[model samples]
Target: MLGQAKAFSSFSTNDIQQTKAFYEKLGLNVKVEDMMGEMLIMQLNGGGTVLIYPKPNHEPASFTVLNFPVQDVEKAVDELTAKGIKFEQYKDLNTDEKGISHQDDFAVAWFKDPAGNILSVVKDK
Candidate 1:
């Protein structure tokens, strides 16, 4: 019954301004809204919105909160790296020097936002 409802993902940040700058640097369309308080609305390229709200005691999520699927994981990683983004290396996950892990039919690279929230870029083979 709720399938038709337009749902969006939301996450908490300690500082909205810093979060906004980080997302903007990543080339996301972001806008500030004065709702319950100042919040950020990010327009996803694939079509959807993500709500970013501020909380005084915000704690970063250990798991990835968002994932961007790209045609070429290497290109995406290189571009983001050039933009000053650092990829996370996970020895247990068998990630490569570039921090990308090759699974059965896909490769994924992980990084963190300014607020320390994890995000990833994935490519399917």
Candidate 2:
């Protein structure tokens, strides 16, 4: 039986500082513990959070990687790019363009967090 949807997911980042900074731009705070390159948490202001580790010990999750719901995917993309986050570009895939409004049916954009972890922002349906 499926229980509650994931509250958060985690990724292994090479640089924890940059990783933390990237999500911080998304209004997620860094929940850090002792500096052993152990586990790190990044929590969004009003929603879910993500755990980041230096090296992944368990199996890699072959899934959405990270999902974040936003009010405006375009605005989120613009704001994030302004902060130096690069949205993944695929010629075959339709991506967010222009200002803060992607009417791509569901208004969405995909990018990598500072940790090279795949993440997407979609308007709540």
Listed per model in order, the count of residue pairs whose N, CA or C atoms clash below 3 Å is: 0, 0
After the best TM-score superposition of candidate 1, give how far the Cα of residue 23 lies from its true spot, in angstroms.
Answer: 0.7
* Residue pairs in collision within model 2: none
Q: In model 2, what lDDT does residue 51 have?
A: 74
RMSD of 2: 4.1
| TM-score to native of every candidate shown | 0.96, 0.71
lDDT of 1 by residue, 31-113 (tens): 99999999999999878999999999999999999999899999999999999999999999999999999988889999999
lDDT of 2: 0.67
lDDT per model vs. reference: 0.95, 0.67
Could you tell me which 10 consecutive residues in candidate 2 have the lowest summed lDDT?
Answer: 95-104
What TM-score does prediction 2 earn? 0.71
Q: What is the C-alpha RMSD of each candidate to the true structure, in Å?
A: 1.0, 4.1
